[model samples]
Target: MEMIEMNTRERRRMTLMTRVAEGLLKLRMAAEMLVVSYRQAKRIWRRYREEGDVGLVRRGRGRSSNRTRPAAERKRAVALYVKQYGGFGPLLASEHLASDHGIKVDHETLRRWLLSAGLWASRRRREAHRAARERRPRRGDLVQIDGSEHDWFEGRGPRVVLMVMIDDATNKTLARFYEGEDTAAAYDIFDRYVCQEGLPVALYPDRDSIYVCTREACLEEELANVGPETQFARAMRELGVGLILAHSPQAKGRVERRHGLFQDRLVKEMRLLGIRTLVAANAYLDGTFLALVNARYTVKARDPTNGHQTRPTTATLALVLSWQEPRTVAKDWTLCWRNHRLQIDARHAALGLPGRRVVVAERRNGTLAILHNKRLLTFRNAPAPAAPRLRPAAPQAPHLTRRPPAADHPWRRSALIHRPVFCPPPTSYTAHSRGAENRAAATPSRAVPTT
Candidate 1:
């Protein structure tokens, strides 16, 4: 007798059908045991009589699936993956193959081929448990802002920090590449965003020093009626924009995940384009990359209304978005700031401005403005050596001197001396009135004496 290899279920079914065919068991009993209909069992029973155990095997077993790709195609795809797209994930590789290489295949199909061909490795990522937060209802309702320091040029150029601003509602993205991540870069990028998208209702950022001040004094302010703030925070407050600082990176996961996506896609794209500088990268981003990113990732907002307000005027923005500090005007109407002595106008000092506190606004464009009582004061750069000097008038002719009053004058009658004592002015000031006036005009506010 010939022996055939079969699994337990097939052997059992075969035995029952054989018994039925041999008249040792009823068809209904055979069907019941084999879990098949009597009609199906009868069919099996007839096949068993002629073919014996051969018919017991599954019909499609050991046969190539009709859905399988051709052997030649599979081999070609694996070779292409290994040679060209070895570092790309299955989804990205599949996209390139379909669009660039004229090859049509499902991502999973390509993935399996790459895996079997040892061109790619599989990684299982554990899903993180997080409380889902619904997106804001309207565009610009909440703008998530973050800076990602990365090699965006992917070794084609220097590393740069990409400052990204994403609308929480629509996922619309605005980004720029900078040399580094700092307060100035943040200000510049945000200023550009405001111009492009208007003022967002609120900003969501992590607790970086640029976004939040962590000093003890700042914390004290938080406990007081005043909240702790940084330059960026202060600017937002001045602009009437709300701030929501994330305690952890996961709190603002949208921007964080975007950073990761940008690092992968943007780097590869810049590499392909041979972009090597921040200016070129930013130009490409604003013109072309931004629209592509938005069209691909953005979704409709829950509400149709836009939350952004009209952008502030340039002058208003210059005042509010600048770095401001309260500085006291020196007695001479000079403001010492950033190692430069700025001399306020003598007219301002004549208005009793000495020792008064003024706000020094350092604009993003490297210009400075001195504001007192919300009004801008005129100032000039006063270098130490070139500062205004007080020089007295030259001595005048003796004829210019007036004669002393007579001893019998009423001013001397009850005086301590026979004649009213005339105290000579300092030698620095001569008897020449015109020369004295000119010297006084040139003197610094401190050097000018009051009568």
Candidate 2:
């Protein structure tokens, strides 16, 4: 007897057919149990009775699928992948194979082939558990923004930072490449986003110093009893958009995950396109890559309503999104900014521009302007102050001549040789005693003390 392989369903059917053959269960009941049509059950019963348990096994077993690719095609795909697309994930490699090589293989099918060929290893990551947060209900309600510093060019060019903004509701994204993650990059990307999609109601950003002022309050700010604010924050406030700072990268995980995806797909895409510079990368990003990403990733929001405000005018945007600081005009109608003296135009001199505060704005285009009460003021670069001249040193005084003292001068005489001499009488014992008595009699004694 030949051993036949049968799955659980076949074995179960065989048991049911055995019972039906014994008249223990009706064929109709067996058909109901197997959830098959009565006609199909009858055919199965007839076949089982005629050919035994072996016939219950599926005939298609041990036969290749009709949908399977030809051996030559499989070998060719594997060869192409090994030669040119090594290290690419199965899905990405399959896409490239389809688009570039005309090999139409499903990513899942290609994954199995790669695994079997030992070209790709399966990765099973144990992800940390996180509570899922529901997305905002409307598009433009909250946009998550982040900067990913990456070797985006795969050693073909310098490493760059990719600034990305993604909608929390729809996953719609906008991105740009910059040399570094700085205030200027943030401003530029944000400006483009606002200009294109209008202003989102709220922005979600990490607690980077570019998005939030992480510095301790300065003396002036402390005296004013206010917290420090970054230029980005100030711009958002001026535009009436809320700035929500995420305490952790996970808080804005939408954009963070987008960064990961870009680092994978965008890097490979650029590498394939031979994009080796920031300018070319950004051009490809805006022109083609962004559209592809948004089309694939964006989904319909719960609410179809748009939460973005109307886009502001170009002038308004330039003014609001600029680096602005207050400068006090001096008595000469001049203000010092970044160590350059800016003289207020003479036409404005009659307006008493001196001793007034004006905003010195450095726009994104590297142009400077002075605005007083939201009006642009004309100004010119003041000439540098002239260096002071040093006075000549005073004429030197004439040299003095010294005279030597005379040899016979008083200053040169010895004191011992010029002194006068004195003589005294010689003392005797009898004369000494009489002199002492005479001196005692002549001096009155103080006898009142005894009395």
Candidate 3:
């Protein structure tokens, strides 16, 4: 009875001694070696001393509580959860789990269970994920990409799409545009990226077709191992840049966040600048708005690789990347862009070959650049004429106001000659009075002789 009744304090000390002196020394030495964690270790030994070996057993081990649920019920609830709300978070899930399915569980508890079953979003994962993303090791490693479709002219003109590429490490917008949302338009963005920002190591973009092409296109190594030959892709291929596709918008959330900022500030900027045409807005975008936006939104780079593979050389870019179709200057020294013939500005005669084929570099924001044999032409904007209005046509006279012919006049109606107002012969031909007319004419001649 005394052995079983060993005091809590003494038993804890004995347990501590057992652990610390397993290889070292006597009980006193062991006790002394129990370190600063001695309070916890001592308490455990004390419990065992008071209640025998049974005290060492867990406090809540054997008997189930009144409020505890059946294992079978939790299993069933998890099944229902996965089927109905596969991707939803736990707090939203718990309400449905309880009210509809009659499974009562705290959200945290449910979260842990779901995690064990591989059904929960990992909070720790999200935290570590954000941290890693926030710490890009190099500036040129990743570029954030997205497309914005809006009426840039605020209903004063056509709606255009703007494809944007911003640096992930520095958050600087390298290029943007006004175009229709299509692969062609996306290539325009890619072209700008090549020229302005140089080749990026990787581009982070949403799963739009431009970023990912079709599945067939992706698996086209056998048929088209040649890589992209489209103007934009060709440039990237030469520079060895890569494209990374995001399955969800949230995956490339940096570009999405930048979009939100642009919506708020860009709209206000347009309003302040009185931008009503695509032309003017694009000018502002390329020039003044750019500097302003970069100043405000560009965060300092997390890594210091400077984000540029190379400052593109005009000579190299010209040789490597083919742009618009080659056109020759006419004898009159005129070049053509779809019928708008241009004169080689006198200042650019330094290019030597007036009749040689030269490449025209058409940019995304509707700007045309002419590169002669080697030198580039500085173009002056051509003045356009104002729209002409149509003149109102002369009024025509009404038909009722015109003069009538003689037959239509009531006064001359009887002059329409009829053959002796001929009366119809009744059912047979009637012999006329030729003899009576001869007798009457003879009587009239005799009367005239007497007169």
Give each model's whole-structure lDDT.
Answer: 0.84, 0.90, 0.66
Models ranked on TM-score: 2, 1, 3
lDDT of 1 by residue, 1-451 (tens): 8877799988998778767767899989888888888898888877777788898778888998899989888887777777776677788778878887788999999988888877778898887898999999999889999999876777778878999999999888988888888988889888988998899999998888998886656553556555667888889987888989898888998999889878877776676578998789988988888888899999999899989977899998977888888788787778788988899887665568788778899998889999887788899987585657779989986877678999888777767555567887656446577687989899878656789
Top TM-score prediction, candidate number: 2
Model 3 agreement with the true structure over 174-274: per-residue lDDT tens digits: 54656576656666566676676676787777766554544343344456486334454445566677767677777787777777666655655575467
Q: Give stretches of model 2 more than 4 Å off.
A: 1-4, 222-226, 345-357, 372-375, 389-451
Q: Which ten residues in a row have the lowest lDDT in candidate 2?
A: 409-418
* Deviation in Å, model 2, residue 171 alpha carbon: 2.5
| Model 1 lDDT-worst window of ten | 217-226
TM-score of each: 0.72, 0.80, 0.40
RMSD to the hidden true structure, all candidates: 24.9, 11.8, 17.7
Q: Candidate 3: which stretches are off by over 4 Å?
A: 1-132, 182-196, 215-231, 315-451
Model 2 compared with the native: what TM-score?
Answer: 0.80
Number of the predicted model whose lDDT against the real structure is largest: 2
Model 2 lDDT per residue over 247-336, tens place: 877778889889889988888888778999989988898799999999999999999999999888998899788999989999888999
